[model samples]
Structure formats: C-alpha cells, structure tokens
Target chain A: MNVVVLNEVRKGFYLDSVALMRLSREVAGSPGVIEAALMMGTPSNAAIMRNAGLLEEGTAVKGNDLVIAVKAESESAAREALDNAIKSLDKPKTQGEAQAAWRPHSIAAAVTARPEINLALISVPGEFAAAEARKALNRGLHVLMFSDNVSLEDELSLKQQARAAGLLMMGPDCGTAVIGGAPLAFANKLTRGRIGIIGASGTGTQEISCLISEAGAGISHAIGVGGRDLKKDIGGITTLMAIDAFDADPETDHVVLISKPPHPDVAKSVLERIGRSRKSYTVCFIGASEVQLPANARFSPTLKGAAELALGHKQIGADFDANAVASRLPRSGRGGIEGLFAGGTLCAEAQVILAAAGRKVASNAAIPGVPKLGVEPSAGRDRLIDLGDDEYTRGRPHPMIDPSVRDDALRAALKNRDLSVILLDLVLGYGAHADPAEHLAKIAADRGQDAPVLVASVVGTEQDPQGRSAQIRKLEQAGFIVAPSNAQACELAVAIVQNAGR
Target chain B: MTDQDRPQYQQLLARKVEVVNVGLEGFVKDLRDCDIGVVHVDWKPSAGGDPQMAALLAKLGV
Candidate 1:
C-alpha cells in the first residue's frame, strides 16, 4: 500500500468534529483510497494516525494541526486522496453563505450600523465570553450567552457585573431562550401566548415549552440561565431575574421555574423569592422529591406536570408498564442497566429518580450519588453516562447535534457482559441531529433483541423537524421500549432491572 | 448581584432583549433565520480563551 501523509496539513484553525467526520467519510469514499483518516494532532488522534500508517517519520504537529493520512493503491493515488481530503475540509458550509459578503467585521461595528440591536447573542468560546459580554454590557445591551467552558469565577463576576449594569447575562452556557417571542439558540419555534418559563437546563426548558405549546398553550417567553446557575456560587442570579421578569410581564399570566435539583441554599433563596410572587407559578425542579412550595408556587417533580399545572390542565400520562417491560428481561448475561444518555439534564434527572427509588446509579455527571465516570467508570450497579458532558465532547459537537460519539459510547457499553438493559434519550428538535432515531436504528441494529432490552424516550413534539412519530418508529423498530418521557424511561429501565433473569 | 444593584435589576427587565453572538457565528445566522434580530461579535477571545484561562485554571487547579 502506498501512503501519502500530509504532515501538518492545516494549522492554526480547528475543524469541528462534524466537519472532521464528514471529511474522513468523503476522503475514504474517494477514488483509489484504500483507507483514510483526518484528525487533529491530539495525543489520541496522533496515536490513531501513526498506527494507521498515516504518519511519516519526523512529523511534528501540535494539537491545533490537522493531519490527513491516506493509503491508496499507488503513490499517485495516495496523493490524490490526500488532496481530496483537504478540499472537503476547506469546502463551504453553504455555497450561497460563502459567496454572500454581508458578514460584519465586529460587534461594535455591527451595532454602529444598526442601533436597533437591543440584545447581543454571545456564543463565543467560554474564556472570551466574559470580555465580549463586558463590551456588550458597556454598550447598554442584554446578552444571551451560549458558550460553556467558562470558569465559575468568571461566571460569577460576569453575572454580578451584568446585574450591576442593569442588563441580562443569560448564560456562559445557556443554549435556549425566547425573548419577546424571538427564539434564540437551540430554541423551538412556538406561537406567542401567556405562559412564561425560566429554566437552568436547556433541554428541560425546551421539553416544558414544547409540551406547553403542544397542549394548545403558547409560550410568552422562556429564559435559560444555564445548568450551573442554581449552584451555590452563582446562586441562581439569572433564575431570580427571569422569575421577576415573568412576574412583571403583563403578557405572562402564569410562569414556571424548571431545573435540575438546585443547591439547597439556592433553592431556598428562590423559594423565598417565589413566596412573594403575586402571579401563579409552578416549580419543576426536575428530579426533586416532594417539597412544600409557598402558597403562590406549586412544586412539580416532572417536566410534564409543570406544564400541566401551569396551564391548569391535565392529560393522560404515558404510564410505562413495569410488567410489560419485566416480561422481556434478558434471560442471561448482566441484569443491570448501563444508560448512555445524550442530554445532560435528562441524565441527571434519571440519576435523581433512580437514586430516589433506591437504585444504584453512577455517572459522568455531578449528581450527589452519581460519581464522575472519570473517577469511577464502573462503580454503579447501573452506569449512566451523559455523552453530552464536556469530558465526552471536548473536540466534538454535542451528541444531540452529532450522534457519532454517542453511537460509539453505546457500542462500548453493549460490550459489557453484565449489561441487561440499555437506556437512552433521543432528544429531537430543530437544531438537533436531523434524524437521530434513524441513526439510532443503524447503531443498535447489530445488538440481538435478546441481548438487552433498549429503553428510551424522544424529548420532542410531533411538530419538530425530525417527526416524533418517525423517530419513535425507528427506535421501536430497533427494539427500544420507547417511554413517553425521561422519567418514564428511567422507570422502565428500573423495572427491567428488578425483573431481569437472575 | 449585590444589594445596591436592586435598581439595575429593572434595567434588563425593562428593555427588549437583543442578542450579540460572539463566537460560532452560526448562532447569529440561526437567530436571524428565525427573524429574531441578532448581531455577530467577531470574537477571538481577547487573549484567545485557550492560553490565558487554561494557564490560570491549571495554576489554580480548577
């Protein structure tokens, strides 16, 4: 085999994981290419490139360097394949977008051109967000921060400064929000109405808003304060602000506060603030057990219940039949679940619920009982790993937007001899992968039906771009016991565990 | 926020929400595509996000 190693092919800039994977597929399928791989010069990536014979002696590259290694039938063919990989990586996301020269030079410059800009949507890398947010706040603008990887110190300082400056700093990692009926990053398109929501979890906010919109109640606004806002340090700064905004808005007749279980002090602070609310509000602290809320605020333990309580309506819950799931428990092999989830908050909720039910759970998340998968990768009787966590997606897109990493995780978990049930969450929406369940079907197809029962849920409505029914159908076809919600999916998994052939 | 900033609390709630997306210019495109007013911040992390914060985080053992 003839190998042509493009040493330090592209440097200074990084290709996103999606683009990297797409480039590899494109190059591998090109003519005369026996094998091809394109990756950054990370240690793991360098090892793969070297082992695959895609590297040459004295090839020194940094993590930022792009390495394209190709092997072909001949030297000329290898060079040609390498050339194709470069072209694919350099290709434009959209032909028209690349051709269009309407790109602005900077934020201050863009604001100068159009002074109507009241809000600045900040999605820069985590470290730079504080500086950029400072610039926006100085300009008397509100910020919707969508970047993560920011330090807790910077986050606290930024939020404090925003509050002092009289501007809203939505997130260092906030993913979804709707302001004045204008949907922001990773938000669903919904009609304007009276129900307003503030959540610390992006997907949790989405799940509730989508549920409300589907039940014939439109959303007035939804603000995401990020996952860590309710922690002790940040102390629910944005959450309190959002609640007051919803309280003051005449358009928002009722409101809801959704989140993963918050820090005790933060929760009490928020609860005391809610005690003073004049308008009706519901609190769905996702995985919290029963809590006595103030007279004005009702505690909802589930996302669906929060939506239902906010609208003063009821719908039949999709009860996961424990008997039905138990009937099909794996007769042999491991009997515990190893849930591989794509949504962090959903994974946290599952851990919280299972822990409350007295189930042994361990994970890569920060839940109390669930130890970090890094420190204890194999501690839990049931291992639940949130593939969307930063550890898993360091150089890749989120699992929701890119399922390759999640698929890889699932395949790894399936190899475990003690795995009797596999739990997953298929969160579908506009910005999510176009057809995840279609992809899930392909991933789980190799697993024999009797190997382990698959339990899952699709956190989307029928109106999503990826049709809910179609995705559910694909999952069902893959032998997944599709539950109605994340909580139900956990219940189904627990039941499967309880009845697994001992 | 500190106690003195209670008055500024009304500032964010009083105004209409406008977004300035810093990195990932695609987010600006997405908001604009949805007909929501948005602006790109053309961000490169004043100190490049990586070296400065990473060095600090490493030293602080965060």
Candidate 2:
C-alpha cells in the first residue's frame, strides 16, 4: 500500500470544535484513511496537527483558515477523503434553514432582530469566548459559556465584568444549566419546582438535578458557575450572585450548591454568604473535608446526598441492595476494580466512595485524599479513570460527546482477567452521545463471558431524548448490572469486588 | 434578601427565555424542541483570527 498525505485550506472558513470533530471522525473512518483532522488553523491546533503528522513541516496557515488534513493508503483515497470533507462542510445545515433568511450574523444583529434576547449561550473557541461573552454582557445578556481552554486571566476579567454589570457569566467551561424551565446546553429537562441549584461542576449538577427529579422533586433553576469560579482568583463571584438571585426569587424555596472542594478562602466566603440567605441550602463539596456550616445550610459529601437533602428525603439509594446485585455478578477472580467514567464529577464521586471504604483508588481526576494514577502499575490498587480528562481528550472529542473515544479503554478493561468488575457511566442528555449504552453494550457483547462483571449506571431522566429506561435495558440485556445512580453503581462495584475477596 | 435587593438576574426568572445562540448551530434543535425561542448567530473568528486586528476592530466598535 502506498501511503499518501494531503491537505486543503479553506481560507477564512470557521466551524465549531464539535462539528469539526464529528466531521473529522467521519473522514478518518473513510476507506483506506489512517487519520484525518478538521481544525481551525490556530497556533495550538496547528501544533496538534504537526504532532499527529497530518501537517507537513513549515506549513503556514492563519488562525481563521479551516485546515483539512488526511493520511490514507493511496493518493486517490486521500483525495477522496479531502473532497468528502469539503462537501460535508459546504452542505447546508437543515436544522434552522427556514429561519436562515432572518438569522442574525452577530450578537448585535441578533439583539437588533430580537431585542428581548436576554441570554447568550456562547460555545465559541476558548481564545474567542471571552470577547463574545464580553459582547453579550455589554448588551445586558446573561452568558452561559460552554467553551473550555480559556485562560484563567480572561475568565477573571470576564466574570468581574459580568459581576459589575449585574449580569451572570455562567461558564468559561460551564456545560449544564436550566433556567426557568429552559434546559440550556448539555442540560436535562427537569420538572419545575422550588429547589434551585448552583453548580461549579457540570456533571455534578446534572447528577444531583436528575436524582432530585427522579425522587419526585423538581428544580426552580439550576445555575452553572463554571468549574473554576470557586477558585481563589475568581473567588466565587458567579456563585455569590447565584445565591443572591435564588434568595430573592420567591419560586426558589431551597438551594443546592455542588462543586469539588473549593479554595479554602473561597469556600469560607461562600459559606458566609449562604449564612445570610433566608432559604435553606444544601452544599455538596464532593470529596471535600467537613467544614463549618451556617444555620441554614447542610453539608453533603456526594451528589446523591445533596439531592436527598434538598428533597427532604432519606437516602435515595436507601433501598438499593448492593449485596443482592453483587451476588448476581459472575465473578471469576480476586482482582481490583476498574472504573472507566465519562463524567469527571461521577469519577470523583466514585473515588470518594471507594476512599471512604478504606480503599486506595487511583484516578486521573483524583479527589482530596486519593492519589493520581501513576505510570507504573500499583499492586491491588483499584483504579477509577475519568476518560474526559485533558490527557485523553487534547485532540479528540470528549467521551460524552463521542462515546467511541472510550471504546479502546473499555475493551482493554473488559479483557483484563485481573479485574473483578468494570464500572462505567452512560450519561444521556442533549449534548451527549445519542446511545452511549448501546455503544458499550456492543463492546461487552464482543468479549462474551470472558470479561469481568460489568456494573454500570445511566445518568439521565426518562424524558431525555435517549430514554433512560431504554438505555438501562440495553445494558442489563448485555449482562451488565445496571445501578440506578452513579453513587449506587460505585457501591455495587465495591460489593462485587469485596465478594470476590479483594 | 428583600425583593428589591434581589440581584438583577432574579428578574430574568420571571421573563420569557429568548436566547441568542452563538457558535454551534447544533444546539438550535434542542432549544427548538424545548419550545424555547432561539436565534442562531453564524459566528466565526473575527478579523481572520488575527488577535491584533480583532482587538483593533473591537476598539473601533466594528
């Protein structure tokens, strides 16, 4: 086979990262194609292409150019893939074509066309997100930024501007939020209730909100304060604003705050602000050590616990029979547990639960007490890996958006005879993959009974586009012990490992 | 906090949610399916992704 490389530059063309990634995936899967990438010609993206050997040495391109690079078995294949990519790019989007004639090209034009536009959902590249968000704030709009890789300094300045203007800047990397009853990017369609949530972690918020909704409780509004807002430099500016907003809204009777352990000073100030609220608050700083709580606030260590508290109910998993679930598993060997998760917060929650059970679980996104996974294998140590970490997703799409990204790692874990149980999460919602469980189920089916006991959970509601019950049925039919929630999945995995004499 | 002391964003809760979606057109379907009013902005990197030129355009209010 004669290997050939080819490139095409669409001058001043632009596409969002997600679209580019999806298109790249299609091109790479074409006949005889080894690799393909569709990226903006930004400096970082150029470096990525260079490192992937898709770009020739000394190839110069402007940041606004769309770079289509492909490597294939033959020149014809490479040329075919390049042509396919361009055709896909030029194809008209069918979703909003009816309104295409009236569609605005800029924030200013959008506001001019619809002057009542109150929110801006910004998902541009990180280098440009701050500018777009700034433009939105200047127009008196609340911003929910779904973009990541933004500089901390840019985040600080943007948040400060939003705060000064009495507006909200939800994220530089904010993923999930529901305002009034409208579910924003990567959010769930939750029932309307009096419980308001402010979350720094996207998946953490989703887990808690879904749990609350599943428990027959609903949400008034779920505000996302981007992951870094509670750090020292940003100082929880959006968090404080969210608290004040919830306190003032008569519709919101209770508030839930979810995040990983925040900066100590930031946490202290947030707690103090929560103390002043008339409404009760449930704060779940996942994996954070105990801190003093105000009279109106209760502290929870897990997302499930926060949801249970907000709902005034006993543990949502109180009826979960871990032993019964474990007993049904076809355990073969005495081995450590392997957790491969797409949700970062779900992965951290599992690490916390495992660590609390006197187990040392190594993870890529480790909590306070747990240690990071080392390059060398450690004997008898359980491993929980967050596949969405930058280490695994620098050039690839997030596992949640493209579940195939976790296929190789999942397949490896399935074949590992030393693993007692392979734990996983299938997150479903608007922005996630269409049918993540079906994808995983196919992989597990390929390995047959030779694989370890597969324990999993679906983090979504029945109302989600990918029905929760259907996803669970797929996993269970594929021989997976499907837990109701992520926390319970961890518990079930632990029980299986312990039953196997770990 | 009293009703008057509420942060400016509290008022947003009572108003209808009309969104200006920047960047991805893929998100438009989700919003439309939810029956929320949305307008998509065909966004691209400004000034051909040249930071100096983009900054100058911003200053000029273009």
Candidate 3:
C-alpha cells in the first residue's frame, strides 16, 4: 500500500472552526484518505496538526493562514482530497452567496446595519473572542459568547465590564440560551412561560428547560452563565444578573439555578441574593451536599428534581418500566456500568446518581464527591465518560455537534463483556447533530446478542430540529431501552446492572 | 429605586431579541430558521491573528 502526506497553506484565508471541521470531515471521507484537517495556522492548531503528523517539521505557517492537510493511501488521492477541500471551502452556498454582499464585516458594522440588535452571539476562535465580545459590550449589546479556550482573565474582565454597564454577558464558553422564546446557540425551542433558568452548565440548562417544556410548563428564558461563572474568580456575575432579570420580569414567577458544585463563598452570596427575590427558586447544584438554603429556595440533587420542584410537583412521568425491562435482559454475572454521554452535565448527573447509590463512579469530567477516571483502571468500578470534555474535543467539534466522536467509545463499551449495561444520552437542538440517534442506532445494531443492555435518554424537545420522539423511536427500534429523561436513564441503567445475575 | 430599575439586563427580557451574530454563519441560519431577526458578521482575526499585532492595533484604536 502506498502512503503519502500532503498539505497546502493559504495565506490570509480564514473560516470559523465549525466550517473548517465540516470541510475536514468531507475531505477525510474522500476515497483513500486516511486523515484530513482544515484549520487556521494558530500555534495551538499547528501543534494539533503536527501531533497528528499532518505537518512537516519547521513548516512556515502563520495564524491568519489556512492549512489544509491530508494523509492518504497515495499521492494522487492526497492531492485530490486537498483539491476537494479547497473547492468546498471556496464554493459558497446559495443563501450565503446572496447574503455575502450585505453581511457586515465587524460587530460595529453589524450593529450599524441593525441598530435594534440588542444581543451579540460571539463564536469566534478563543484568542479573538474576547476582543469581539469587548466590542459588542461597548456597543451596549448583551453578549452570548459561544467560544471556549478564552483566558480566565479575559472572562473576568469582560463580565465585570458587562455588569457595570448592566448588560448580560452570557459566556466566554457559553453554549446554550433561549431568550424571550428565541433559541440561541445549542438550545431547544421551548415554549414561553413562567420558569426562568440560570445555569452554569450548558446541558444542565437544556435538560431543565426541555423537561420544563415537556411537562406542559415553559421557560421565560434559559440563560447560560458559562461553566466557570460560579467559581471564586468570576463569583457568579452572570448567574446573579440572570437571577435579577428573572426576578424583575413579570412573565417569570419562578427561577431554577443549575450547576456543578460552585465555589462555597460564591454559592453563599448567590443564595443570599435568591433569598431576596420575590419569586420562588429551585437550586440544583449537582453533587453539592445539603447547605442552608434561602427561605424562598428549594434544593434539588438532580436536574429532573429541579424541574419537578419548579413545577410544584412531579410532572415528568417515567418513559419506560425499569424493572420489566431489566427482567427481560440476561442475568449475566459480569456487572459494570458504562455511560457515554454527549452532555457534560448529563454525565455529571449520572455520576452523582451512581455515587449516591454507593457505587464508585469515575469520570473524566467528574463532579464533586466523585473520583477521576485515572490512567490506571479500577477493577469493577463504574465509569461515566463525558465525550464533550475538552480532552475528547480538543481539535474536533463537540460530540453534540459531531456525534462521530462517541462512536469508537460506544462500540468498545458495547463489546466489553465486563459491562452489564451501557448508558447513553442523545442531545438534540439547533446546533447539535442532525440525527445522533441514527448514528448510535446503527452502531448498536451491530452489537452481539450477549452485549450489554443499552439504556439511554434524550435531552431535547419534540420541537427541536431533530425531533426528540423520532430520535427515541430510532434508538428503541435498534434494541435500546430509551428512558424519558437523563436522571431516569441513570436509574434505569442501575436497575439493569443490579438485576444482572439475580 | 426598585431592583427592576437597577439592571439593564432586566429590560432586555421585555424586548424583542434582535441578534448580531459574529463569527459563525451557522448560528445566523439557526436564528433565521426560528423567525428571529439576525445579521451575520464575517469575522476574521484582526492583525492576522497575531496577539502582539492585535494588541498593537487595539492600542492604535483600529
């Protein structure tokens, strides 16, 4: 077999990471291509290309330059793949071409064109995100920053400026929000109602909002505070602001706060502020032990519990019968649970549930009270993996955006006879993968009969671009027991594991 | 002054959301699909993504 490596660097050319990733995926799927990557020549990206063996030593590439690298079975294949990548990047879609003539080149230009624009969604590369966000804030627009890898100092500074100006700075790495019935990046289309969500975790916000919407209740707004807002440095600036916004908005009669365990001092101050609010609050700090809550607030240990308390009852019903489903499975002696999740918060929620059940849960993105999945394996220990964690998504798109990231892991877990059950989550929204369930269903269909029982849940609405019911139907048809919600998915997986060998 | 009058963010909840999408065109398409008002910004790294150059340009008020 002939092997060849080739690359082309286009000076002063640029595309956003998502477009580049899409282009790279297209090129990689070309005949005989082993691997392909289209990235800007930033130091970090260049390093990624180098580590992937796509770049030669001492290759001259600058940050503004576009790098297209392909390794293929032959020189002809490599050349063809690179040409196709370049062509794909150059070819403009019909709508984009029509709008290209009038699209603004900067935030200032955009604001000038639409002066009524009160919100700026910043999704540039992390190095350049803060600058764009600063410009947006200066223009008196609230910001939803969808880019990650931004420095801590920049986030702190940006949030402070937005606070002083009384504007909302949603994130430097914020991924989800639904403001005034408008679904922002990576959010479900939810009905407008009384519950307002202030979440530090992206998927936590989505799960709560989707559950609320599914319960016939609705969301006034689901504001993302990034992942680190409740840390000691940021001190819940956006969270506090979102709480205030909900408190003042007459449309919102209740508020739900969701996050991993926050910095103790920040949590205290945040709770104190929620205490002053006239509206009732449900605080779901996953994995956080019981603390003194404000009189107006109730504490929930899971995302479903948060929605339940906010709705004033248990409105979300069970999607499947766990005991009956477990009884149908083979009673294997092997008993280990493996959870592969696209949502980090879903993974954390699973870990919290498993930990509370006296099971030692290890994860790459472990919340408080759970141990990290170390390099050395612990025998018989349950593992929940957040494929959306930075380690899994360094150069590739997020698992929610590109479901292929979870494929190899899911396959391995399914084939592992040591596992009694495999837990999974399919997140659906505007920015998520078009049909993640189809991708997983195809893989699950290939698993042997003796393979572990597959239990899963979906965090989305029926109104999402990828319909939730359709995704669940696909999974269920492919031999998966689909739970209604993420928390129930974990419980169902536990039931299956415990029922094994009984 | 009441708490409602203290923050400008609260006022945002009462108004319609008109968005200026910077960096990603996909987000623009998503917002438009939902019948929300949005404009796209064809964003590129200023000063060719060089940190020093970008900082210099910022200092020069570019």
Q: Which residue segments of model 3 deviate by more than 4 Å?
A: A92-96, A99-101, A375-377, B1-6, B55-61
Binned by DockQ into CAPRI classes (incorrect, acceptable, medium, high), candidate 3 is medium
Summarize candidate 2's per-residue lDDT along A438-491 as a digit string, tens digits. 899888888856578888988889899998899999988988888878989888
Write the candidate numbers in order of decreasing TM-score: 3, 2, 1
lDDT of 3 by residue, A1-502 (tens): 7778898999888788788888888999999999899998877788888998998566778878899999999999999999998788778689967755467788888888779999999887776777888888888999999989888888998899899999999997898998887888999988789899998999999999999998898999888999999999999999998888887788999999998889999999999999999999999999788778989999998998899999997757654677777877776538889999999999999998888877777888877656688754655689899999888888678999889899899999988989988899999998888889999998888888789888889999989998989998999899888888898888888888778746
Q: DockQ for the candidate 1 complex?
A: 0.27
Give the Cα error of residue A471 in candidate 3, in Å.
1.2
**Where in model 1 is the C-alpha error above 4 Å?**
A1-6, A9-21, A24-82, A89-95, A99-101, A289-292, A311-322, A325-333, A374-380, A415-417, B1-18, B25-29, B39-62
Evaluate candidate 1 and give its CAPRI docking class based on DockQ: acceptable
What DockQ does each prediction reach against the true complex?
A: 0.27, 0.65, 0.68
Candidate 1 lDDT, A234-260, residue by residue in tens: 999988888777766678888889888
Give each candidate's interface RMSD in Å. 5.3, 1.7, 1.7
CA lDDT of each prediction against the hidden true structure: 0.73, 0.86, 0.87
